[model samples]
Target: MLLPRTFEALPELPKGKQIQVDFGELKVKNSEGKTVKLYVIVFVLSHSRYKYTEWQEHPFTTRDVLRCHENAMEYYGGMTEEYVYDQDKLMTVSENGGDIIFTDEFQAYKQDRGFRVYLCRKADPESKGKVENAVKFVKYNFGKNRVFHNIESWNEQCLAWLKRKGNYQVHNTIKKRPIEVFALEKPHLREVSAPLSFESNLGSSITRIYCN
Candidate 1:
């Protein structure tokens, strides 16, 4: 029988040690009064709780995820020693017992960046609570009742919101503003030697995987 899930308080992590990444989706009406879904991805600094988010008109492929990873790193001005992720199909092909088989593209990307990864099952509350909260926060607090103007405008609004509210507000758990905490966390983050670029067939997947 499956045991009941428990949410243990997450301990404070070392500065620049790890970041958690998660993806979610929300629906909004476009300029033409049509409903559309946006794919949202977020990355959070484990120590400071600093956050970076991106929205796309298309579902993310492995290459798209790679590029977004680079973007998130640059947004933070660096990367961390490790990344925590859910068992996303974009990265992981399969898992058995404690072993995980990652997608080919993701395997190479991780090796090229030289960072460690810790993945957990979706039901692992202790592991997913933070990021899952972030996703819900974005969906309800920001995306809810918000009109979809365009990808660029939506992203701009998201960035502004992060600065105005998301990272600036005093966190409920830590009792400190994330931006303030990030001042100390930034120095501990690992530097990115070079930005990653994918092109031609390796670039973003503009069309949905099953899109006509």
Candidate 2:
């Protein structure tokens, strides 16, 4: 993939910036009523490359997305200045006149945590390349050939694997590990005591719900 001339140079850490979030998924079996396994959505952070993958038994919804972000922030212990996602209807209720109408719970979560949200422009995948790359990397490495006996145990294993692979792996752009860059960014980032203890309005029990 040829990068635009604008990205020819490496990106610098922006002031008051923490990192970005991306959505990803992995295939899993719905033993309750499955003819076969299906894809389970996962969220990843672009800066630390720290990830929180979960199995969604129901159709992905607004609450599911917020819960995912809440969990991710707790797992990382900080918040990003902005969230970048391709225009998915669940998170984005509507868009008009440069204003994005996000879901009620989503707005509450963002307001409570203090971050901005930006939807990727239509048909412009290049705008969020870093997150796209991270998703692909996660699927290929962690999702491949994985038989999850239990999502809880599997997630623990995944987190361990992510720490080893994401934290330690040398980043191509900066030729440094993600954890290294993240460590440098953390001291400058606004510290949050923890994420709010919000129950899943959708009513599913996420093993690692963000109560941090």
**TM-scores, all models, native as reference:** 0.89, 0.76
Note the Cα lDDT for every prediction shown.
0.84, 0.62
Q: What residue pairs are clashing in model 1?
A: none
In candidate 2, what residue range of length 10 has the lowest lDDT sum? Answer: 4-13
- Candidate 2 has what TM-score? 0.76
Q: Which lDDT tens digits does candidate 1 get at residues 117-197?
A: 999888775885667677777777889888898899999999999999999999777789999999999988898876767
Best by TM-score: 1
Query: Candidate 2's error at 60, in angstroms?
Result: 3.0
C-alpha RMSD for every candidate: 6.4, 5.1
Supply candidate 2's per-residue lDDT for 32.
50
